[model samples]
Target: MHMDIEKLVESGSIVNELDYERAMVADRKLRLLAKTNTHFKHLRNKLRNLIVEYEKRVWSNEDAVDAELLAQSDRAQLIIEKERMFLEKRKKIIQARLKDFSLTQAELGLLLGHKSKTHMSELINGIKPFTLQDLVIISKIFKLDIDSLVPKYLSIEKIDRISAVIEEINNPKLSKIKPTLLSAS
Candidate 1:
């Protein structure tokens, strides 16, 4: 990753293929984990229940061993929920920004340094995740503030500012307006 950063700094336009490949693998693993997390949750709940029942019978005087485990499980569940929500929110924001910019999948693919539009489509559809590097490049190409890409980090003021900028960009008449010279009376 350090070498990749150096390459990016030196070339300015080149992306390290290895870094992208690693990100793709990481993305797939995350997606799989998300899909299977419910199973883990179910197991945790079952284990907690069994521990509680055992404690009620043979270990009535014993300390609650499942308390720590249950707390950890709850924390894990919360983290998973937060991550899922973040991903969903990010996907919507990216889709909206893409529409606002009027960029096609192929065009976006080129901008993101992907040779195939399929890869771009996958990224867009949440099949392939967007890495931090991808987000930086996309933000630069789209002239978007990085905060606007993440729903949690975005504020109402920032959204208003982004909207104003988009309006200015889309309205040719606004750009064409010339400043009138005022004569002092």
Candidate 2:
């Protein structure tokens, strides 16, 4: 297994084979995308189940009106929204990867066995949801091991900066408490 991974990473350097280089990079990109998709799918399912449970409660008793249930529903909605945004981001990354390889989106779509450029574009744009099987197909085309992709895709140190900014933005009280008294309002 380790040998296969090394082979993939070293594919770019194989003698007289530029295609190997392309394959290696594509493999890396596809693996990253598949990992991201898996994360999104798992989160989506969890949110879906929570929403279902909440709906069941509401349906069972019209007068129940659990404030906590309502709050959970709101949280579920936010999670879905955030996941949608994340999907879009992932699509953009995929598109960018195609661009980096100087491949037309249509060409990439073809490579991925997608005939319709529009549909392919939608996939690349994260406007369409892909089955896990589709992600596997993508990895096959790239010749990558799906298991090796997750850690690299999920480890993002910069997320802390973004989270800190969002935390400040969401807290009105914190916003009201100016960091510096001398700063103009």
- Measured against the true structure, the TM-scores of the candidates, in listed sequence, are 0.41, 0.38
What ranges in model 1 sit over 4 Å off? 1-65, 125-127, 150-185
Name the lDDT of candidate 1.
0.49
Model 2 — TM-score against the truth? 0.38
Ten contiguous residues with the weakest lDDT in model 2? 148-157
For residues 8-44, what per-residue lDDT tens digits would candidate 1 score against the true structure?
A: 2234322222333223333443345445465323433
Local distance difference test values of all predictions, in order: 0.49, 0.45
lDDT of 2 by residue, 1-185 (tens): 00122233333232211222223333433444446566334433443344344345454586776786565445434333444445555566556666667878788677767888655744654434455566676556555554422112211123335446757688776555434221211
Native-to-model Cα distance after best TM-score fit, residue 73 in candidate 1, in Å: 2.4
Query: Of the candidates shown, which would achieve the greatest TM-score relative to the real structure?
Result: 1
Clashing pairs in 1: none
Clashes of each: 0, 0
Whole-model lDDT for model 2 versus the true structure?
0.45
